[model samples]
Target: MAAPSHGLTAPLSGKLKNVNFRIGFVELGKKKKRVFVKCCSSGFNGSGICIEKCENWKFDSRKINHSYRVKVQASSSTMPFASPKSRFVSKQEQFFPRCTPRNSGPQSHDAPPKRDTGIANEKEWGIDMSNENINESGTNEDGSTWYRKSGEDIGENGYRCRWTKMGGQSHDGASEWKEMWWEKSDWTGYKELGVEKSGRNAEGDSWLETWQEVIHQDEWSNLARIERSAQKQAKSGTENAGWYENWSEKYDAKGWTEKGAHKYGRLNEQSWWEKWGEQYDGRGSVLKWTDKWAESELGTKWGDKWEERFFGGIGSRQGETWHASPSSERWSRTWGEEHFGNGKVHKYGKSTTGESWDMVVDEKTYYEAEPHYGWADVVGDSSQLFSIQPRELPPGVYPNIDFGSSMPPDDEPPPNR
Candidate 1:
């Protein structure tokens, strides 16, 4: 561990300097630079504001992570700032290093020139593999736009390739777009591995929103897993709001599935969060839970939670539910039944005013129809969107290649989880 070192100190002499904040990091074997907004403007003299930011970083040489903190002093004259003099790694970089692009600049259709290429596993497989590349971008007749870039290696046994594509439309000062990427390898009668990513964005007057989902699969059991995230932010006439959420799912052919999701956001003086998930056994059994909580600027708070199990696919139900109100009222219930019968329930309620009640009674419950569980699907296909085989490339259409070494470094960190 190293002591926190100060990176910048503003002089107290009243002279304002345009903020020129720059930081560098070597991520994925490439150096990246970040430039912050120019600060110390006179426009904010009468406005009261404060800002604080903290970033976590991991050095390759150190076993533990480090925290880089920045604080802006809130005052009338100036906003003095303090920050740790160290590099940091983003949550995205920590988790999805390979899935995220190394460069943060606007993605162009141009591919980096090939630096050097060599065949791997040539002796073991006795196959000579050659590199193929492609890069194309153009506007379609429908007024939509599209771009594609890819590279691959083909051998006698199998092939490995990576590609990215983006297409969308813009009109009337509003736009919607989608981008997709894939990296995969397959060997005949052997193993396979791959990752795929899809992202979409929508923007309009005073609002912007985006989401990205990635899927991974391997040959071990042909099991597939999916990860997804989304964020939306908007502002209207002196009020602003933002929300973000992340979720993941894993499943296999053997009838086993698991999923989890969580989300948190803020609106004006209130902030809230909700998370839920369910698991289904191929044999007709399911387990699920939901938790939600919220708070207000005035110190009011409330929350709800539910946990349930359905035996033989809703043939029976057992679960507990809890709710809390901002007025200090609390209510809870629990029930268990086999096939909607032979069940008992316990109920309780309490309030800060010293009122409370509890009771027990016989209970019977059944779903009139199939339950929707908790979370709605972000992308269809039950969360298993990929197969074991890699997508085939077009024939004899290989061109521009960047060879990975020439791509610029990513300026922005991966999105926070």
Candidate 2:
């Protein structure tokens, strides 16, 4: 026996020997090294068979001192090397040269396939043994990994499946392309239960009904009744007194003084002055004798008082006297006769035929007349007098008066001015 050469071994029968071999410490360079061996046969004329070989045989520090060994046995020459039995096994054992054994173990007949040991069990490794058979749960199109309820099929994409649950819950788990579960036949029952507990349907019907009832009972009825009453009062023309009374109440609450009532009497005086001043042309000078003389002649009546205040004592001494009759015709009056020398006056004169005695005076003369007139009469006359005044006054009186500066050539003056 060749002392069982290392890791290489052979079976014998005077034919090529069947042997197991492993490479060990076959040094190639100072740093680069490898080890390789395989099952082979030794025969005449350098005949050797290689089988079950290691891939990329190399040597490292851990395996550099390791060795390969072989074994063989001599046998009769009647068995040829080409025989199938001789190729596989022999009757005797023999050893090969240049090999040694590192440890004692039964010689392996086959080598494991070359593969990455870490990922050997992965699905991508082309090994069907590692594939998982997952049963999806739920009835949805997405093939997710879960035990599906009965009557369900794994969806084509494996993300979902179609299934039915016990309690009539139809699991159509595709909510926005995602899987979900819900009760099918119990939807109406669920709604009714919700209505019984929360007093509403899923569509919010009872809530809307409650809101509508509130609006009808509280807002709509009250507001409609108030609006109807307001409309009736408006049509009947009875709102004026009520409106004024309410306005008066509001004004009183806000601390607004009554028309002629003021603690200092200043508001009354100011209002009276405003009433009189508004009618007078401030540019014309006052005359001393007119207001007093007119008051005497006119018997201190309300009309005469307003006239006195209006013209600031109208008279001839101030300047010219322009009088406008009720007919709106302008006439230059005898200054002394029509207006007192002070610029205020109440002139009573009949027409040229003395048929009717009518009063004529300037706007200033009217202001002096208001104090003696009844409040109603004064208000009425004031309105009428204001109506007669030229709608467009000189800018000296009202800065904002439009004087047709920007009007087109063909445009007529505004009507009824």
Candidate 3:
């Protein structure tokens, strides 16, 4: 039996019967070693030898009229054979041949097909700009590219850091890309900004999206503003093919001081839809408003407009909310609740969904209090915020993070540090 170089140990003693043996050479790694004593046990009529369960050693077989018991010994050392009838084959063959190539003839059709990239010989093209403050810029073997950089500076009061990365891929005439940039400064008046963008383009279809945020904190006030927008279009390769959509939003530190608008359509078919909405939270009051309309590709249409506001706490508030659909379905609600200085309350509405009767509320229901929104809801603590420090991997060393691209080109091993 043929065993792995590492698995071959002291001589292996086994039994065989009615067998004829020959010596052959099997290629192992970069060298060929002689194979002796080929036989199978337990009646497996294969051309290969087997000791116990091993069946990878190959040899020629012939019918012998006389049956006789024979001992087989496999070892790491070679054995010499001097029998006049003994035959030795020197052809270097694989110990365990798993496949035979089908296209081994001289004719082109019989030859293996060549791997085809779009270009006949698309040589790699890229540039390296790695330095103290920046690192990693190049193209990958699969025609994808990426750039990344990071830096930090310690100031008198605190520190500031920034990071940016952009990557893209091209394949089968389609392209996809993304980028992110972020900065944070905790020195004196704290400030931070971040932006992200991504998009993809394929034959007759494309989409793009972006998000940005800015935050400022000082002794007097803490403020933040975040915005997001996206657009998508497909002209010729999808059901209801001519499609389009765009939306933008703005959010502030105030709990509900957020506003946004969205629009979509099958523009080529003249069908369109839009929505606008806003929210407010402050001065012991909260309000929400929305107005939207839509015309579908099938000529169906609908519209909805509503607003709800609450002030003076719990049961003492006023607002109205209503909606109407193309099916003539209607819903409406209105409220006008007031709280008296003596703890008494009065409530009224034109068409209310819940009970309109007023009752004596809790003593602090109408107390003066300002709503506070914490930055932790959107950002993080110092430890979490500064956890992503700049890294300097040696050239040819790739980090485990996803680069939105294929594997980078192979490079020579970096010198030992």
Candidate 4:
């Protein structure tokens, strides 16, 4: 449970107990330290892994004496399908880890940004960004966790970690080898549920002081929501309009700080997914809102915002709030969501290419993309011109729409944000 030495708290901690069953996601929300979550299981083989509970405590700057308060989201069946008699529950669909960062923050800037410009920044917490093949691995001598510090760049290393455990006494549990940018690699040994004593032991190694075995779950239970600090009220309670110039991963001009759900079939009789976030621009006039749902049957809303970094990148500090490049780029890309002041509500933003988008809040329309098609554009909605859904945008969309050439460079792929 050693945390990163910055403002960010540990977003997640998962150890790959079974290779076929990886922890899907663990993340901190947009409203600073107030909101966070850690989901488990890859759903690869119908295996059920979950974070039945959540609790947190703060260590003094000196890193001593953390007071933890664990809340069980569901007492029974919280970590279901790990029972000794558990059977393989398979479906045609596969559930990936639910740990994708959305860049939906506050919106600012009286004018839109130049979306045509390009940038890139990858969120692979613990892998070599430069040399995907060259990785630096480390194990928690005392615990069940292991880490791979990226050798690709100067400041890339273990920022976040995820874990999972096998269930049932019929077997000695399971172990696995992990290897995903945000995923754990290689299982060393087997363990049950509940990982206690996450703190480092003498000689400096985190130990899983204790683990709880899975109690068979006959019926699904609701994942109890862990209460947290107060959140900032911005953009109808959204973080902010999260899009910025280039919104790309390659141009991480500012060292910034930092998922989805599924497989939780009808926890309490509903199977649906919801995600919402916001972002702002430099002038504090632009804004973006996103309200997306997966199954669409349930009417509950999910909350999160776009981020500069992530769970491990949480505490990263910003040296410059705004930095403009020689090209058409705005340094405000790393600013916080509340940095903008546009008081508009725009929903259903489509990631034109999974990064930039077109928005309309309070009759003002905004668009962001690379220079190829005019980065930022703004116009009063007096004509009700932007009333169409993003899907309805004209085929050429914004005109001169580049179909993208021979695939973007390896480093410049469209972002999940």
How well does candidate 3 match the true structure in TM-score terms? 0.38
Candidate 1 lDDT score at position 93: 18
RMSD each, Å: 24.3, 50.6, 24.2, 25.7
Model 1: what TM-score?
0.40
Q: Indicate whether candidate 2 or candidate 3 has the larger lDDT.
A: 3
Say what the RMSD of model 1 is. 24.3
**Scored by CA lDDT, what does every candidate get?**
0.40, 0.23, 0.39, 0.23
Q: Poorest 10 consecutive residues of model 3 by lDDT?
A: 105-114
The all-Cα superposition gives candidate 4 an RMSD in Å to the true structure of 25.7
Candidate 3, residue 26: Cα displacement in angstroms equals 46
Query: What order do candidates take by lDDT, descending?
Result: 1, 3, 4, 2
Model 3 agreement with the true structure over 271-295: per-residue lDDT tens digits: 6555555444444555545555556
Off by over 4 Å in 3: 1-132, 135-139, 145-161, 171-173, 184-190, 201-204, 218-283, 297-300, 313-376, 379-417
lDDT of 2 by residue, 320-341 (tens): 3333444545543332235554
Model 3 residue 376 distance off true place after TM-score fit, in angstroms: 5.6
Report the lDDT tens digits of candidate 1 across residue range 86-195.
12221111221111122221221111111111111111111111134546665533344445455564554345544444433332213333333444444322222222
Error of 1 at 389 (Å): 4.4
Candidate achieving higher TM-score, 3 or 4: 3
C-alpha-based local distance difference test score of model 4: 0.23
Candidate scoring better on TM-score of 1 and 4: 1
- TM-score winner among the candidates? 1
lDDT of 3: 0.39
lDDT of 4 by residue, 81-126 (tens): 3344433221100111221122211111001112222211111111
Q: How well does model 2 score by local distance difference test?
A: 0.23
Q: What's the TM-score of each model vs. the native? A: 0.40, 0.12, 0.38, 0.20
